[model samples]
Target chain A: MSQKILTRMGDGERLAMDAQEIRDDIRRGTAEAARRAGVPELTEAEQEELFAILAEPGRIVSVEPGREVIVTDDGCSMSFYSGQDGGGVGAPLSRLQAVLTYERACGADTTSMGHSDYSYKPVKPIINFEANDYYNISQVTTAPFLYGAQPNMGLYFQPDGPCANAAELMPLGKIDEARAAQEEACEHLRRDLVFVGRRLAEVGLEGLNFDTCGSAGDADYLAALQAVEELKKDLPDLPIIMGGAGEFVLGMHGGVEYQGRRLAGLYPHEQVKVAEAAGVDIYGVAVSTATTESVAWNLARAVTFVKAASEASSIPVHANVGMGVCGVPMMEQPPIDAVTRVSKALVQIGKADGL
Target chain B: MSEALFQASVDAVVRGDAKKAEELARQGLAEGIEPLVLINQAFVPGINQVGEMFGAGKLFLPELIMSAKAMQAATDIINAAIPEGNAQEGRGRFVIGTVEGDVHDIGKTIVVALLKANGFEVLDLGRDVPTDRLIEEADKFNAHIIGTSALLTTTMPAQQKLEEALKKAGLKGRFKTMVGGAPVTERWAKKIGADGFAEDAGAAVVVAKQLLATN
Candidate 1:
């Protein structure tokens, strides 16, 4: 790892969450839901609100549509606090297949609004808010507009290769052609962060999902955080959902090599904590199918992490086991037995533990 | 007896033991394994297992891909050694590809294996195939079935383009066309005038067979 990539192996003893914890939390959620008399699973809207309470149970918030949010064809505008998910609203996405498709749909058709007053609807949609995750809020806010299968400029100008390393990124470093390629990539992300910030700020978002960055180590992480910061500047109320480094680091990297823990190496817990300390609306880890199931142990560890992060963070945390990993898609076709077992265990253990 | 060897071959392929899979297949051959017997017994069940596992999520894309490769290895040996006039000889020629802009192919690969296993001579065009080229290939091969897959919502239009190109080229009735993918509903396939449609690989062969007979 680069010196520039600072890590915080802090004594926060907040070490990683375990499978049992996740199973317990899941059970708790089920029991709580059962007591409520057939609310069934929590909706995406409800989960976001629950996270807000978890992130800072001290404050009040919501995720449903409301007066503070302004919807439009160009974009949606919101000015309310947001948190992350609570449960399986859309069949948990860890892969790009589901995420990319859903993100596109959410961006195209969805909008939100909210305030402390809470007028139109009872509780506002509790969207997750991660503020300190990047430098430019605008780039992240506008990211959806530029990316996805939808006809955004990112695709329009993109030269058809890796989104993170397209030659189209070169213009950002016009002044320094030698490092122009790298700088261009940075610039593109920075712009996307700003876009994300702008759109989200409209929804009172100072945070991000942090799942799609596809980066690791300090530099990539810092660049990502810097982009968040930039967006936060324009939208000061931003929050963040930090380091969804599912699959791999979710179990402390490769579990066995590190004595049945995620490798303490290069994982960015310290940076995320720093963001949390800075009053990020949300801060916690996340896992995906790839992160959770590269080994059977991963699936077990992921349940633990989801439980831990959900309860631990002052902000809402959740898991996203979408449909694909890198290119090897999975979510749509996990074994029936695995789904049954995982779901049962999560409800029995991870959910019951109250983390 | 051949059925037992075929079943063993499928088990070996699933376990990722290539040597074992090949040995079982060779054993079936020495026992005078009929191509169709091997296909129906070992290959179809094996690929069907892929479908079941995929549906259940026990296996992911890589596993599907790996199994397809494994099945192909076994198919090459089995198809060649068997006589040509076998009743189950797969001569219902089909050309398949992913629609433009969508590179996802795990679904298509399974369909390819099943199609070949079913005694259909399949021309797999791989992923992100353009519309015109798809039409060109089907016309070139005089294929009985022209298949298209679009995993992304945006690229689904290519399926329609394939249909239109065939109509424009006067090859409309020449090939029975089918389209598939996660987002591709059969209603959409019908709306776009596809001869057939399937949500998964196993059903694709069934649909392809029905489409060929209908055409």
Candidate 2:
């Protein structure tokens, strides 16, 4: 019999379950989510492949070196805080240098200037578009020197800042006021994205990532969708990677709609259709982990969601796997065993084009 | 007539109408209804129902937040009318913030709202708060628990620093410490000697209550 696979729960508890049991859980978990989402379930061959991958007796696993897929990261922060203290203490030139070091070491396909406050709202005030043509122009101009050979280098931000402000209104029973605020914030966010996209494009930036879209619910998602639509019209060739904060939209605004579909309660399969409609070049799918559940369970569920999303999407599918989502343990540094297995499952079985 | 008013109070909260909930609360006060009676019979049930629906996935974050706001608006009025000395007895005091160098406040904000709905007196220090400031404010508030949240790996050290600072001050035993965030795990909590670890807002409440009960 294959050795019993060791894994950890979402909360970091150790579990050593029979290989067959883990395979069974993977099938059962994936089927249940597929049924609920009205997406196609995995075929028997795909299930068997996932089982084989998990049953392998290795401390860590990876795709065959020649068969490796593209790897990209959102909010790449390692280079941002290169100094001894916790804060972002490094200068721009040194930070870019660190990105170069990380790229060569880790073999990431692309690198980003990870902002602690990675949102357009906070960066808006600092960006004097009229005077300098870009916010943080120093970093924007210098990134090309280090990353000249890379096909893509761009800006990333979450549409989360305004969502927080709108949520504040809901408590005072200011529902209408909150809704109006979200609408206004959406417009402002779209304008900021356009301004930044245009400025970055002028300096050879090739992509933009709307990381963690819809974290504040429907309105937040709407803002990102609209921004992508606007950005596509301005720069048709620019690739936009739209990643979600959760598997399903939270319905925070509860009643907002986009392109006639309700923005609230949208699962990955449903979410990708809207993203594609808005001209998203790459759809980043995420499934949150249940801390009490085992990694096998979370990985199976994440695969199920990602596979459905990949099938339904016309755009490339990038699976977000790290920390708390995509079957990785919810910790600062995830164990390599879980990470490798999840990555392999997503690419081979879930049909993910990138990670 | 009184029964109808109480039902209306519950409905106002379910509807997430803070102004209506506040209005009904004032009306109840004017009619000589006991403050505690209004809270126990009306607002608590309303917020409880909201929490239940949220867990069931029938409600989402906005609906839940609005309901909590409505419940708070009514409860604040009712709480003030209670006898001063009897007020806030046994209800734990919680001091919460996103630690310094981290601006992610959504998770911390949700915890604050839920804690308030669950009857804890919460002092929200907001985001990017320094470690020393958290201790100082918690001490001033006589807080029973101090919760720190850090969303980034770099900022997570702030939580460990908070733990060290509390020990250095010789106040470790006095205040129960809770740590949470997207990147935070139970292992980190134990490694840093934190008293409690919550994976999300719902778990935060349970861990907090258990921590208080144990001590």
Candidate 3:
């Protein structure tokens, strides 16, 4: 269930909590703890205390069928929807929800679903991050109406833990088990999409974006794509967006000569031919300057890839920055500025309308 | 003749044929080729090349996995034939795992393979390992370095917890600490008292080696 907790108190009243304020408090707490440790590092005790403060959102004061009020022990109460936003689960999703709500308030046109680094939460069972699943949608109930933007669910295909460890285990002749795990993951992706689609519709979400790190074999990719195609039948109203690195997408289509070298992938034009045939609504090209030595070069490269994808696809195309190259807590004081610059360039130069 | 056989062993791994790689190792043994030669000259070189191909996007996970299997098949046979302590000589013992509350292990698994390929005696504790488990394993293995990977920003603090746990247990400075993951930054590592942080597998191997130097 999605539930929001009131964290801070105002002048004898509760104020609407802000994601940035929460982050700032955590950062300041960590820094102060580090300073008190006298070694420029936070002690484990201090670290745990900080994380607890970050993760804990106080206690429930009142509860109804769909909404509730959660009050900190300090007497500050935050009213939230218990069933819509992931209120009681923990701080990660709640914090992310607050951020998305803030972004919508700031006139952002698109609310990209999923976290920067995507992992299938149920498949691994170890990752408990907030940007995890559709059930976390209670946090963004008003995004569609607020921003006039369709919510996009960015589905991650890679499975971690034993499933991902299959690659390592295979070298030791442990193929069957890992292969079965991989297959199980594909099946999970297949089955979950339908449930996720139904749940998103309940929350009024309208778009589906496919995302993968491109480590899976061709068979795994095929299985995921087939699952997607099947889900499309059920949710034909939802537009689908195909997203990944340029090389992997092109390779899946055919082969392409990149930088005078024939890589094992199709050229941009040829790739779009396959995408259009598969009924892709939009093509998202991951453009990053992580490999480039300078900011100007990175922007230039981002523009080049975005333009290429826009021209290649008959449908709308968008840009995903670096495809998880940059680390998390990305929407912050500094990185947010970079995101603003790059996003503007993407829309202006690439002739893209959304991100 | 021995050089030709060793070269064939490399080819077997590059081609990702487990049966062929195992057969070549047995063949080299029968032909009186040094087991060390089979590992250093044949298996290591092939896996290294595979890592390069993977980084460059020329190779996918399937091929990389197959090559690792080929390399392992040969390495297992050669390791069994060689003296136990001899195989570990000149290599530092490294223990790694994903911290508690985070189960992401793909990146950690890659780092393990690269560390093993680079001559480190790597003990992968797998994902969702608690701080106590890591500490216990490090003690059991007499590890020179302990590493943690946390893919979620929420779990990233566990790295710091592990560091603090080490200090509380009087094990601080006894083992070098390394932290990494998609959400991990160099600043975070420094704040948490980590000896090193790597962005990916290749950089991880380099950082692990550098940490060993300081340790």
* Sequence-dependent TM-score of model 2: 0.75
TM-score of each: 0.46, 0.75, 0.63
Instruction: State each model's C-alpha RMSD to the native.
Output: 16.8, 6.5, 15.0
Fraction of reference contacts reproduced per prediction? 0.00, 0.31, 0.07
Q: How accurate is candidate 3 locally (lDDT)?
A: 0.54
Q: By summed lDDT, which 10 consecutive residues of candidate 3 chain A come out lowest?
A: A70-79
Off by over 4 Å in 3: A1-105, A110-172, A198-205, A210-224, A245-275, A287-308, A322-333, A344-353, B1-9, B22-43, B73-88, B117-119, B213-215
Write model 1 residue lDDT over A92-114, tens digit each, in one string.
33233332343365643322222
Per-residue CA lDDT of model 2 for A185-234, tens digit only, reads 66666677667666666665556778778765667788888878988997
Worst 10 residues of 2 chain A by lDDT: A145-154
Supply candidate 2's per-residue lDDT for B53. 58
The most accurate candidate by lDDT is: 2
Candidate 1 has what TM-score? 0.46
Q: Give the per-residue Cα lDDT of candidate 3 at A328.
A: 8
DockQ for all models: 0.02, 0.23, 0.13
Candidate 2: C-alpha lDDT: 0.74
